[model samples]
Target chain A: EAEVAQSPRYKITEKSQAVAFWCDPISGHATLYWYRQILGQGPELLVQFQDESVVDDSQLPKDRFSAERLKGVDSTLKIQPAELGDSAMYLCASRIVAQSNEQFFGPGTRLTVL
Target chain B: SQQGEEDPQALSIQEGENATMNCSYKTSINNLQWYRQNSGRGLVHLILIRSNEREKHSGRLRVTLDTSKKSSSLLITASRAADTASYFCATDPRGGSYIPTFGRGTSLIVHP
Candidate 1:
């Protein structure tokens, strides 16, 4: 069904290290989102992008996290000096340009920070 | 967080049984959606009910929304072992075109 694509499905790292995840939204989708899903909890939005411009990042920990969609298609999320609490699934989602609510999600990256 | 909150955090059912989960929100919305995830995978969109619509159905899935009560429900009929997954309800933000907010999901276990 032309699903969203993500890389590095699983990652394990030590605390204070850095890691990055990548996502490629469905072709022609213009809106992208990054979410953090903790154990037994719903996904929490971290950042959003409209094409190449960031639309919302209020929930993002800008101090250590950064996300960019340089070409308005593929996007990357980076976390520096990861903390134990940063161990969670990082999900990337996208929606069609004309739609604002329905989103397509990618197989998220399960990060384990020891 | 403006997230929908679901009830009966978890449910256990046998194959061929019906499973129902409810979600409640606190603000006006343009749409509400239900998503499902397996043990460890990305969320899969199930059904979406718009503010102006009362109910919608897809396959064995049925979704109902009540704007007056700010609540919704998802019913999966004739469940299967593969139907075991976490279901989440998401609501469109009230004012502007903000990102959709999600509620803690209902974990459904279908016993074969």
Candidate 2:
């Protein structure tokens, strides 16, 4: 029953400020994903990481967002100069290499920008 | 942009009743998964139906996938107040990548 771990479960900040969220996947998981969920909508993929390398980041806004998993274990997502539209629930998920396609999710960080 | 769309955005049912949610996708998939998310919480995996499989069940939840029609349905029988949550359908397409597209979700409120 190991679960993904996320920090700063709730964050409130003003526009133009910098914010960062962290996630720690399951012990043996090799694939980690970052997603953003707007109100009344499903989660949208922002970036994906395989071990320490980024696999896909097409949906991520490069000008303001960046994610890294330097050690291939824990990951951090940062948004510089946050915007009002950035207020959403940031979720992290992880999947094992040889297991089923089910991805384990963390509690998520709820970001509110004023 | 998501590949799946769910019908009946919201539903309210009394306790001990059954709840059904339908989902439709636009592309060929390797698997279809159902997930539940309570208010202000993370998502919990419910069940998954592979492309080659037509029907699957877990506990009181039953999931059926029609690959030819590109549709899937999730049924929750004898539900309780705790079953009140938002349900989402995610699809992993048949290809090299592993990312799954998620639909907006169906909100179900089981009145006690």
Compared with the true structure, the alpha-carbon lDDT of candidate 1 equals 0.92
Clashing pairs in 1: none
Q: What C-alpha lDDT, on a 0 to 100 scale, does residue B54 get in candidate 1?
A: 98
Best by DockQ: 1
User: What lDDT tens digits, residue by residue, belong to model 1 across residues A1-114?
Assistant: 799999899999999999999999999999999999998999999998999999889999998999999999999999998999999999999998624658999999999999
The top-ranked prediction according to lDDT is 2
Model 2 chain B TM at: 0.97
Segments in model 1 whose C-alpha atoms lie over 4 Å from true places: A98-101
Per-residue lDDT over B1-112 for candidate 2, one digit per residue giving the tens place of the 0 to 100 score: 8998988899999999999999999989989999999999999999988999999999999999999999999999999999999999999877767678899999999999
Off by over 4 Å in 2: none
Candidate lDDT scores, in order, read: 0.92, 0.94
lDDT of 2 at A12: 99
TM-score of chain A of 1: 0.96
Compute the lDDT of residue A57 as modeled in candidate 1. Answer: 93
Residue-level lDDT for A81 in candidate 2: 91
